[model samples]
Target: MPPTRPSAVPPQGDTGARADAYATAPLLNCLLREVARPVPGAGEPRVYRLPSGERLLRVRGGRRPAAPEVNAGGTWHRVGHAELVKLVAEELQAHTGLSNPELPAEMADSRDAVAALLTARDRTTPPDDPYRRSEQSLLTGHPYHPAPKARGGGPVAAWLPYAPEAYAAFPLVLLGVREDAVAEEGDVSALDAFGTAPPGYQLLPAHPWQLDLVGPSLTDAFADGRLIRLGTTAFDTWPTAAIRTLYAPEHDLFVKFSLDVRITNDVRRLWRHDLLKLRRTNTAVSAAAPSVTPGAWLSDRGYRTADFAFEELAVLVRDGLHTHLAPGTTPLLAAALVESFDDTPLDGLHDPAAWWTAYLRAVVPPTLELFARHGVVIEAHLQNCLIAVDATGTPVQALFRDAEGVKLLPEVSRAAGWERLVYCLVVNHLVEIAEALCERHPDLDPWPAVRTAFERQSLRLDLPEATALLTAPTLPGKTNLLLRWTGADGADARYLPLPNPLRAR
Candidate 1:
């Protein structure tokens, strides 16, 4: 039987409290992981000491920690989102000896964004489709990023309508670029189906929200005959977990646009350098896909944009599920399994161990094999992966997408590539899912199964990294809190050692 649907929406009137709880978890995770030291003890609410300010902090729950309290004169007091932001800012400043005016505001903006999303979700009906629900279910996104949901700190009205968390689906605003001014590579033929351009132009669809942001800069192009506004797409495209990328079910296509907004770490524009390398990176992954069976690579087919507004107006066409997904399966975002939704396959499982085993089987091998054989290190983080399940909710296949995040072996040192893969696959992806599964099934220990998965895959592929992974005492956890505090580039990943769950008995 298919899983029953439960309301994933926040309880009606407690939106503020719910938002605070949802927002606080990730921020706390960042602070705890990057700056604070855990105070060892057996207790209901675990305690931690902020090394910078010598402050005592405690929180209830694991994975998504809540009910945060700070010790003041040997007494505990609750801290709300605002107070928590203040606390984090102070802690980070003292810890790093660097004050960032922007990150703190972003931390607060992220909390406010959650409140706005909750308010929007209350009025909006979630999509009945399980896949759509799973894609939109990331209310507490990037569980370790301080400002995962901050939409460039813009007013809620500007970005909320385009938010995937609110179950938003909107039509793409089509534009016509003068044929002479068009700069494109690979196969972007799917874009032509959206609408027709005049004889001298090519059809280029733009994200409505992006169009609004970049519209002012395109005045000269619009005023001249270089870019003409065509109408909107007849069918609405649903935004995936990656905010700028949208899935068009009707066309069986995924179109990614460049948005000039900071989401999580960086401004999400499709930069010229990345765009220049897209085809090469995508080609390598596509070639490697056949070697890894039961796991598919959703090929980013091509991109289209006006040469005049290359990065700002660029749109990428990606292969859709019709071509890649298995016959009798529905693909759910792997990240969604961590941030659950109504009818999540992980919910009420008869045997969570078996389910988790199958999950590891579907997800791990392809990632490891691709690296060992093809020298392709995909960003196999939860958001970039899709776990397809049968009607019985058994994970049958894994699909991975997003070419922009991929790394080629020789391009980066073998050690660097392997480090990136381990961080993405182990710390970011598997750990989150394992914790979520254990959260649901308290008696189930997920690490042994994880160890077995890696061991089996390592033996099959003769991958030395996988073998070493089984015994590694520490995993490289990305220092997102420190990265932002230091104003490091988003792509410039820095790692701190985290206790390896796989190595634990």
Candidate 2:
């Protein structure tokens, strides 16, 4: 189907096609990553050996992987998204004897959410700005996550307005927190500039989704004048891939709010412990970031919240893209750079080899530098990093964010921190990107550039782990399937070794 223009509605048939494609990608990713082993050599309908001996599974290939089938009775029986979820559930129950009633619904909800997004977007206009387009472009998120697109099982009417994929932009709902109840650290004064607060109150901006979730509980606070409805910011903010985080392009600032929704693995809440350590972690990373490159860390400067309703009303203020962005360059989401975008810098590359090299340079150096020189373990996953491109859309710089995700060295044992860094930086970040480049330009070999990027970096000589990374036979791949099935904390990442393509040929 052709791309739908703004104010145009796609035919019902096209919506279903898009929905299946969007929904199945994550399901296939989960199945292949957790239970299926390759059939060694298979054509078109790629075959895999399921855990239950001799039984085979087949799927159409692509980054997303689609059209799954199980070979039985000398025929391939097709499995739609619902059947796939059941298959996964049955398989997990047999494997672990664990039955999660919640996860299955979430899986179904994720697919339903995609169908709704497809249906809604057909009638709406995609963002015209390149940055906004890239930010709103993720239809299939966290490619390996089982229910990456799930919106906490909320109704389409409740969550669709806030979904980034639907090109959501809205003014932040502002509130006045009584001065005595306001507890903040570092620089949150920037938030106050969004709106005015009366003499004894401070401004607190909230994500509307979060407000919807927690508003009923705040009745007493409102009744007692502890919280006052001060209306919304004058301008609208774009929701980034991190749903709770909003970018106010007009002010060039970002506001991170505590949301109760479970996106991907974790309930998107600003935990009290994380809020307390926010300034320390941000300071450490900010101090380390500058030494690495012109690329920067948007400091999670500070937060504002009521002591009574702390995490519920908490908001973290961070620097915007403009200050950290390289001059004259357009910044794009790093994850979106890998996704299929109409005018992504990765599109129609004249020299993919050079572009991949530049991508490695812009992204890798700063990440490794923070780990080696400063003991800062950046969760330098694709989503956390942004690639800035020049006028012609060649990548020029990399910017990193999210203090909550960073693990400071010595704070976490060196070995433990390095493992997390490897999973996030190489397995989660670089590997997918390499595949994306290969997918875009099939004839091009992306690994040699990857091998060179890590092998020749001077910092690797200082950090012993970097040397091992290039020649290492395997890298740690996060087991998102098993994690969710076993009900583990999202941060408590369990990794299974994956074949390392960065090895010397």
Candidate 3:
């Protein structure tokens, strides 16, 4: 990682067009040029900064268009366009419990329409009846909303991007309350009942972001922890303003916000901290084996940056796809090792050493090249990545989180930031995993796999950039994961020697 800087700066909603009002809108371009300049007819729109540092423009007179009077089951409530956005925000916060609710382009219209649209979005799903019929409002209590499940109940629908369909969010409301309770009583303790805290990992004192999920109970938890030594107002780069909730009923499951310069420097540092925490959590989770599954990602509630509060909602599975490497699980380390040595793994084929080879090949090159590609880059270190596996011994998923690691393509930022991304993602993450894989699978080659991954991902890069990523040929030291340098003639293979077994004894 580049020399760590002590500090830094700042940084949605659904659109109405596609899914309905409650749907996430398209990303609005914040460029000043994109802003509609005031003219004769349209009033000067109100500009507000979102939590992520993006800007929101409200047309001064933009009202939610009036709906035609209908003799329908439910009456259409009249509201303004901006009020619609606010309601959407409130509803999202109410449902998803994320800190900020985004409004994309499609949802940016009048009030009554937005509300009707939001209602329609939820109503589109099939109701949970014996026949599994479709209904507009499946889960009652709050507003008439979509039902995530069909009556017979196969599997819930996949949550959508932008405008969040009420999959997980709506479930929080379903926890403990009656169908009508959500509608009448705003409090949603009905669902919080199901969220059992993992053994020893007591729920950390929640920040405001988690208000919707944990309910008011967090306030009590915080006060108790503070009165004792357990709770702390320590800063995680943000003067303790950013509350990190931990469920260490047994072990530490780190909870922190995504990067937001406006909120505090901690947001930017979250990736690194989380990585460290994941490692720690993994060790703890492993120790408690029979009781707790080795968990990784925890939910991130509310995080406010400059103008808006970004809401994060999700129950993360720790590298669910790549968990074979966990303790007691058998992994084909030999195949992983071979892949790290070269680029021969991504051909839709598998090798015992596929994991190792792929790591060295793909992870390292992109990381090292990031600096030259842009001035300010991102770090794709270990914490941001999630390695997963399927039933059979095979690599299935490699989920990368913490968008903060995505550096500005050098042209956008600077060498300082850009290089951090390269170092963190490629060198730090890929290399370590490659090393671990190599330790397990010695027979497989990592070289070809490394080469193959670079060739695939680097399809858009130039030769030099490509070469920088594939810097294996230039590294020094036999034990060094990246074969940085192989001498003038590129003579012979020089691998790191095995350690003396006697040393352990």
Candidate 4:
């Protein structure tokens, strides 16, 4: 897709008025993916059989499905987010005979959140910096998630100040942890540069919102003089697409903090179990994929936290783009690449096929090779991946991060790991880019090039899943709508079968 105007200035005015359409699309996708059924032999006005006593649901479809209607009495009526939420609640209760008042409220809350973000954006100018703008560009997040924008049903004021989508940036709150209570692992020495801690303590950086979240519980720690405030960083760090992670442009570093809010399916806390396993996962990934020219891994160097408030105040030191990113190349979040931006290098391409070829060449091989050789399963989803483009805006490098999401072999069954790998790489990451390309170049069939990319790599990879991958009719698609509604653990991913594009001729 061509780099369009600022997201706030979409094709339709980005007013509170169009927030319904913007908010409704993702909701509809969630409903369709999780519960809606298609009417057999239905013609023209596309109808999908929805869950509430088998009600007929209709919508205009393309990439952004719109104008949802449900058949009631003799005619069709529009279903806004409120009505949609009610319908979903009713259907869920009827289908499972279990009422979830919370999810319905959350669905409505998500709509309201979108409205607020739109209002905030229209009044505030988006950052001119491409990277910052890209970071803030996710207005309608997770196209298939039910409550993608819901901020734990908390008041907007509680989170709005630090919202990356609102072009917000703030300095991290640094703390001095008592030397006795300081619990750290690996090389977190870079944290020492944020500010000097008193000789009796070590430097610890924390997310301000999280600090505010757990303030009452931490009273004893502060009273005992285990934690001391050391002020903030000189330069403000911009929150990346992952809300917990912040990128400091000056130091060229990323620091991840634990926020207990539930963004999508899971509470965003950096759990102790995951943190305990981080070093081993990170080391495996680094060894699995060495310093390949166009492919790199941004290591999560180490983490620092006080033993007293382990998960709450933890800060992860991540390798910055400076070392991994090719010199003279600008890297943007792959998630933002799919959304509307002021200037996207992908838009500059004269040939979609050639550009697609380069993209596949840069991204596909290393991931396959990693799994085949090292048995490291990378959660290479959009938020965890970045594509760096040369001066021409063509992609030159692929960088991946988030060791917490990576799984090693034998930790999970090989089949289970493969399912995760396919969903993240193919369904979550590649599908979005492919759809954007097809939208811009309607005549171009991007899947054949995708097929070619896999075929070339299959020769190098010894994995048996490769042949089945090219021909499998269905692939695992994470059922976010159901996952959230059922209150499943965020990492406890349950996938539904989706029509596989790779299988399409």
Task: Compare the candidates by TM-score and give the number of the best one.
Answer: 1
Candidate no. 2 TM-score: 0.96
**lDDT: which is higher, 3 or 4?**
4
Q: Write the residue-wise lDDT of candidate 2 on 308-389 in tens digits.
A: 9989999999898877888999888988866756687766689989888888889888888888888999888988988899
Worst 10 residues of 2 by lDDT: 1-10
User: Candidate 4 has what TM-score?
Assistant: 0.96
- Candidate with top lDDT is 1
| Per-candidate count of clashing residue pairs (backbone under 3 Å) | 0, 0, 134, 1
Q: What digit string (tens of lDDT, one per residue) describes model 3 on residues 1-505?
A: 1111000100023443322322111111111112122234423443332232222333221111112111112343344334444543543344333533222121332222334334445555422321011111211111111111111111112112111212111211111111221111112222232344333322223332333333443354235432111332232211111113222211122333332221111122233333324433333323332222222222122221111111222122212213223443322212122221112122233454754543344334434343343332333444344334434434443333332233344224453443344445443444444543444454644546655655654664453444454543322112110111111111122332222211212
Residue 472's lDDT within candidate 2 is: 83
Task: Give the higher-TM-score candidate: 1 or 3.
Answer: 1
Off by over 4 Å in 1: 1-12
Candidates by lDDT, descending order: 1, 2, 4, 3
281 in model 4: Cα distance from truth in Å? 0.6
Alpha-carbon local distance difference test for all models: 0.89, 0.84, 0.29, 0.82
**Residue 160 lDDT, candidate 4, scale 0-100:** 88
lDDT of 4 by residue, 168-225 (tens): 8998888889999988888999888888899899988888889989889889988889
